[model samples]
Target: MSMPEPKTAWRLLKSAGVKYVRFVIVDIFGRPRVDILPIDEAKDAFIDGVLFDGSSIPAYGGVNRSDFVAMPDLDSVYIETWNGGKTALIFTSVMDGSRPSLRDPRNVLKSALETVKARGYKPLLGVELEFFLVKGDPPMYADGGVYFDGHLLHTWPVLEEIMEHFHLSGIGSTKTHHEVAPGQYEVNIPAGDPLEVADKVLAFKILAKSVAQRHGYTATFMPKPFWGINGSGAHVHLSLWRDGENLFASVKEPREELKYAVAGILQNAIANSVFVAPTVNSYKRLVPHHEAPTRIVWGLGNRSAMVRVPYYGGRINRLEYRHPDPSMNPYVAFASIVFSAYMGVEKRLEPPPPVDTVAYELEGVRETPRHLGDAVKYAQESALLPEEFVKPYLALKEEEWLSYLKSEGDWEKTWNKITRWEYNAYLVNV
Candidate 1:
């Protein structure tokens, strides 16, 4: 069930003793803006929605027609994990009059999932988010631990608190541990329906940051927060199901449906890179020889390939897309992936054979687009991404790239330095 009616939802909250509600909406840049509501007004806010000036939100709208409303997706209502149940939080999808707003990230995903369900299938997703804990202006690592470090005494308490909040928020964690890089960490959450999974991903980021600050360190999801060290990435594990059976897995060979989905993703990989790695710094994490994928190829357990079919067979089998970073808007990112898979299923396309060797060194392999400009160009010209979505997205990305060009920072001063913009923009906010 998506959710109960607004009155029922508000009544449930009232029964739980929630005094305040925060209606959240994520913008194209992956920033969450909230509208606070008292318990008395929440029911009306849900039924009629809350008005906001869309022009004030970056890339949302212009002055000519900037008014928009945020109607809470009641299915997404949950107690604020960090706020002790006194407050509840719900996500919103922008609406223009009675129609879904094309500019809203949640609406984009919702529309795509509706199409997938109509085709008699559901998209299941398991997300792995990697981030770092640091402090200071330039930032010093919070811990010197390495991958699976057994002695992360300093980091454990923070992670424990973060995980506790996640559990309270109803976001189940399958695994959590330190990553290979200093102060880096990873969290694995159980798979679910596409929209719910995306919402959880967003919530996880928010809670992770909130809990980290409570400890005295800043948590960053910036794709490449530091130079000469491993960068963070949010790898998405994708699969499709129908009537509780995984369509991507078969008793014998990989299913034909799985093959088609891979083909669709590869077909649109370049164009959709903007959705996966949306920020300028994301390209810094895509360098070859790193764990990140830079080429458009699939493999079995190969970290260097764009997509990898893990060794797990049967119901657990799925495709892991390696390019996306936690910096992306999960709603839009998942929508693009599933919609691209739809194109593959519709065409019955076959993907190129999976390569077993190191794909980064493999000759004739197509590189995933290198820079934001190339990605923006490919996305604008893509036939798969509808004009309504691609148009505003491209405009926003273009402005981001141009802004970076005019920006003069420490990176420009040093021949090889990471941009300070990423540090200032994401270190505290993300």
Candidate 2:
């Protein structure tokens, strides 16, 4: 079922044992924020929206200054994990009085989805997010179990509780499995409406990690916790449907539209990477092998390709893009996806000749940009994406990168000091 409308959603929250509502929003740096309120304040928040200093949030300051509103998306109201009986969390939409805040990442995505509906297509967007389970206060890699190593593994035995929590919170994930690393695992939700998919991601991250901690361990969504092994992926699965028919599929032997969309994404790959794999740590995961697509190539069933139109279901099926890690703000990620796909629709774009041959060995195809600095530059230079996303997004990230750069030690030395994944996986290669 589609989530309830806001008014009814508000009614349900009032009726529940819900005492305090936390207005949850993600800063431009992908960190979630909360503005807590007592039950008495809920009605005012539900109707008028709560105000805060816009200049304080990363990537949010205006030329002079502006006060922003945090309007609760009431349907997003749910019991926050790890909270005592008094607290509940609700995802928020950024706004200014009656006007929705254009600088808000969530609102930016909502605007993009409006375009999707206007274009007359129902977009099916899904994600498979992977992360690692650890035991330290700071969280460290724990196991060496290859993918699907059952419950016999370490303190990572809380899948049932995690699944149940997701179900009760109204964001049900479709699948959970042990991943290739010892403590790593993945949870997947089936594709549906684009906005809902983004909501599920927001709810899942805060809650899932909270649940993991409840079992006396921490879960890190940091891409690539261990080196040399498979790094984590938020591999995005995309497809199009019009009045109950998949639109990206090929009818006979090949399709032109799929080719166009693939080309468009490749053409925008550098800009897209800034949003998809946002963190400096994220680049460590987007390496040459272990299913990371560092090169801009496409092929059938090849995990290494950035775009894969796998030949699983027959003519004119969906294609999966093997980029995007778990750290992205889902709102921004899905919004850019629809925008890229929209370009495909606009230009009748198509993927390059199916590299039926292996993509790793493919000669002329371009390679994905090398680092976060490179990705940031690409985002600045691209005229294809909405200019709104470009400037604010980069400003947000540059601020974050500057902060991360200020650690006690130097970049060359402390780079791996914070992460052992490179040493564990690619030390020899380096």
Candidate 3:
């Protein structure tokens, strides 16, 4: 949906009996930070924006430039009524004084989208997010269901309630079902504008967690919450359009732009690893034979490949990037994908032949970074993303990797195990 005028949005909220307005901003770590004000005082906030201490947020700004503003995006205005309260939640565009902040994840994505638009292409993004629901202190599975299990009588009600909240919030969820592992579920969000798709992804996480808690369970997006079971992933599907025509459309074989896009992603897959798989536990899910992509390869409808061109044919054809997990910031991850694809088009890069067989059984293929430290190293050495974002992001993630080392010592020794420290650090927080 298009953005309404500020006054019109305020009036809509008031008419809906909204008692409070939530100004939401996503931090670099993909966590939502919110500030709520009564509906009566929200009119001014819509105009002038809300002020907050930016220094408290990681990588936002230092103490010297602590003041930041969150200007509400009217297109993102949605009323959340799941908690038995009328609250209008609006995503914000972060600002520093009179200009946009380079550190803001939303602004970073906007910048990438603008770059793509300048090249006469409109990028579309669809996301499939997988997560798990558990109960108890240490967190055990909430259900014993497997993939596509329809008779989850005890668990289907929770998913139905979550979908109801999504409908109320004006978010589109095309599909919802049990994932491969017990207590794990996947939600498919239809393709749309890149920024809007990212917003929907964030909103999905918030709503899923809220609904889970209300049902006496905890929802987690941690990539590898369990050691033996299948880990969760957030698969991203992308397509390029110009003059209302899909650039990657094809009947049988993939198109040139599609191959170029895949080439670009494979070229920078290692560099983009830190953004897609941001946490220490994320690498555990990337191991060989875990249904996760270990090599930087592309295939035609191959699930094991990092990038796959699903055999949809014609206008619906798109590239599916399978590396990202739910722990990532959608804004940053989407931006990186767009930028990489743009680079491919500009350079006319060609990807290697598509692998029609299992990529996991293949030899002599470039593997993804083994752990968070390796990803950080690759990110530090590469110049694929914006310098402003890469600098501070590496600093924060490097520290996180160091902390893991201090807490768990060597990760290789416990490579096959999910240590207590990992659960303590990432279980619910990620």
- Model number with the top lDDT: 3
Candidates in order have lDDT scores of 0.83, 0.71, 0.88
Point out where model 1 deviates above 4 Å: 313-316, 408-416
TM-score between candidate 1 and the true structure = 0.95
Best by TM-score: 3
Candidate 3's error at 353, in angstroms? 0.8
Q: For residues 218-317, could you state the per-residue lDDT of candidate 2 as single tens digits? A: 6677776666677778888888777887777775454665677777777778778888888767776776657788778777776778987767655557
Q: Give lDDT for model 2.
A: 0.71
User: Candidate 1, residues 293-348: lDDT per residue as tens digits?
Assistant: 88899877778899888865433378889989988888888988988887787789
TM-scores for every candidate against the unseen true structure = 0.95, 0.88, 0.97
The list of candidate 3 runs beyond 4 A from truth reads 312-316
Each prediction's total of clashing residue pairs, residues at least 3 apart in sequence or on different chains, is 0, 12, 0
RMSD values for the candidates in order, in angstroms, are 2.1, 4.2, 1.4
The lowest-lDDT stretch of 10 consecutive residues in candidate 3 is 308-317
lDDT over C-alpha atoms for residue 65 of model 3: 83
